[model samples]
Target: MTTGNDTARTTVVVVTWRGREHVTACLDAVAGQTRAHRILVVDNASDDGTAALLAAHPSRPAVTRLGTNLGYAGGLAAALPDVGTEFVAWLNDDAVPAPDWLALLEDALDKDQGAAAASARMETAGGEPISLGVTLTADGHGADTTDTGTETTGVFGFCGGAALLRTEALRRVGGVPAEFFCYYEDTDTSWRLRLGGWTVLPVPDARVVHRHGASSRPGSREFHRWNERNRLYMLIRCAPAGVAARECARFAALTAVLPLRRLAGRNLPPAWNFRTGLRVQVLTEVLTRLIPLTRQRRAITARAVVPRPVVWSSANPPR
Candidate 1:
């Protein structure tokens, strides 16, 4: 069990793109936390005067502004060197945590020495639950949804918007992959932690409300492109060889089935996105495979402390 001092030791890391209003609300919530904590805001080259606004705050956290937009993975990597605490909490600029959010996550970590990361329950700005529970089948392919106040064990991955991670575990597996600019970065990191003999879970009591797509316009061309590219990257890097094959087959089957199903239901936009995503997936795979180093793949394989078969079975189950 972690001691009292360990529980008190934490640093909050927030990554922002351009949502100044949402970012301000997020910081206000963190400032209201009961537990003593430090905050780090990594601004990803926002031209909307985010730096000026953060500078004007009374009790400001340490802010770092990257001249170029590094996207999600790059912003996380930038804040890593600045994280001096034993535990690090990641919050999206658009997410607001409950007052006792920090305390609950800290307690959850204290309860288990093997806990690598603990994510809080997430709800949408409209009060609908957003992200809380995640279940990956024996294969890396899986889905996530908001939980209904029920505790879950052995989570496949966590939402990067509101998750607390042990610094040592992150260090052991290396930081978040830079290749994943936006989506699936958390899944990649979580897979690494699990393979390194660490556990990730959901803390239902801790809550955060997120304004989805607050940073960018949803369903825009760029949004679809990034989401499409990153999802395929995640399957390649995290899934076991056999599991990847199965997921690929499943994905192909879905591409054929979902479009027709959506069209039948008169949902044109989704069907379009699905078809576009398939094309993007093919291009990304070809480009990524051409690279010789495969740095992310090599890093994951080298630091894996768990047996390949065990990790595979744990992440993928019999269908």
Candidate 2:
């Protein structure tokens, strides 16, 4: 049941690591898309025969192989130069899209000219809905919504795993920040889109099922390290100077209070791991502030189409 309009509009880019099985499942789901999309599987040096699996799908979407692991940002960036469509949809190798996902995203962007990117409802493997977008609280925390069937405003950011970005908007933002090898790349890019006067929308009609934590080992060192470091990096790179300072204060307070909260629950090992990771993140930020912060400041100040007040207020409110 291939739809007639599938060939011309969208290009789907899937980035994969060492998840050959998951990548195969993801590609099968993409092959089931109703609205026809050009597919590109960017293999990030998977040792698990990922390239061979992609090669087997020659009759479907095209495949691009990177000789080395470039991480999420690098893999997607490598695919950008070859994308020749109106919309580019990013799908993680460990996620499977619903049959109508492409159609739904296309419909949302078609109706809103200002939409720079649109995301579908992301669900867990067991069908529990994941919060793909949310409104930001004053302290940089997000309020998740359960109304998974309605269009919403004020979607602060989206997961790169399952989102459709306007080609022109992506071009304007100058593509994903390759400096961010993995985590928070989506947040950084989304903020840049908003600052450039483009809107990011979340379309509930579209959906994808993600196998959470499949790519990384649970409670592993790399998992904790990258998550903490990238979280801080994203906050620093995206927020205005005053807002960034406020967020840093809020985050520090939260970290200091975590041990007290954990006293009632989880064991000491995870707690100690978290505290150590936080310390490492803080030290890394202090050591590298001169270079990354200077670059971030230049980027934000140069193309600031939106007012600082709007950006700041959007992030913070009277509590």
Candidate 3:
């Protein structure tokens, strides 16, 4: 890939929370990237020998072990201020990118000055495409693009697990919201970038093999709660009226029916009932937090060059 400017320095950040079996290989792949990048490992106070493993890894990335778990968004927030590089690439501990991933992403970004970030195609180790780019739903859920993924696909934004973000764009948007702490951070950033008049590009040729449950296991009660909690929060804080209204109705409908459904379904597990209650609690959380993030939302939306509908549709993608 051609280095468009003198500031070609790329810093790769990998955040892990008790990712013992995953961090080593993640670092190895980062070190093997076609571009010589400065790798940084942010450990969320992992006691699972992740800290020790990073110390022993051959890559020798700059490691920061926080005193407590600040979640993925917070970890990046803590590290971004100190990042002097032109671009910051994020790779979760459980995800490993192909050698040319960084090169391909940079090339795509260099060709389009409006692009705030570039994303890699995420896939399972077995070659199943996990997600191409985000396709946001009115229900406050983001669909992972899984079909006809071309080499130069454009998207609303890149997933947090495998993305290269421009440093200046992050700074302009106040960085990723640490308040989100975990889920929805990526989607929030995507919308902010779009609203801030920047494009988000997706590069299909750049592939990453991701282990889905290394940090937050899917289908667990905690996973469902955070996902539900964050999804509502995102809709409230940043989503446009149409999206938010749709999600509100969806939540309302579910809340109204779950009690009756639970009564009729005798075979439903205890965990099922518990997660259902958690979803309602998610609504309360969203309402409570919405007031505080409203100012930020207004500020973001006020700068919109890319409208909500265009972003949702990924219209006029970069050539």
What number of clashing residue pairs does each candidate have, in the order they appear?
3, 2, 0
For model 3, residues 189-288, the per-residue Cα lDDT tens digits are 8877877788788788899999987888677776667777777766666677777768777876777777777788845556632446776776777777
Instruction: Order the candidate numbers by TM-score, best to worst.
Output: 3, 2, 1
Top-scoring candidate (lDDT): 3
Model 2 lDDT tens row, 1-319: 2112445588888888987767888888888888877877778888888778878873455767788988888888998888888998888888889999999999989999988888778888787887556455564543444454436444766667799999878987768777667766777777778778887788876889988778756466655555555655666766667766776676677667666767878555553346745655664664476476668757776876886567657656656
List clashing residue pairs in candidate 2.
6-35, 6-36
**Each model's lDDT:** 0.75, 0.73, 0.77
Write down the TM-score for model 2. 0.85
- Supply the global lDDT for candidate 1: 0.75
Q: After superposition on all CA atoms, how large is the RMSD of candidate 3? A: 4.2
List residue ranges in candidate 3 displaced over 4 A.
1-8, 149-153, 264-274, 307-319
Q: Write the per-residue lDDT of candidate 1 for residues 1-319, one digit (tens) a residue.
A: 2112334578888889886777889988998888878888888999888888888766566888899998878888888887778888888899899999999999999998888899888887676777875556544544575655336445766778799999878978878777667766787788778888888878877889988888767677666666655655665665565665566566666656765776688555453356746554655563656343255666678888885568667765556
What's the TM-score of each model vs. the native? 0.85, 0.85, 0.88
Model 2 misplaced stretches (Cα beyond 4 Å): 1-7, 141-150, 249-273
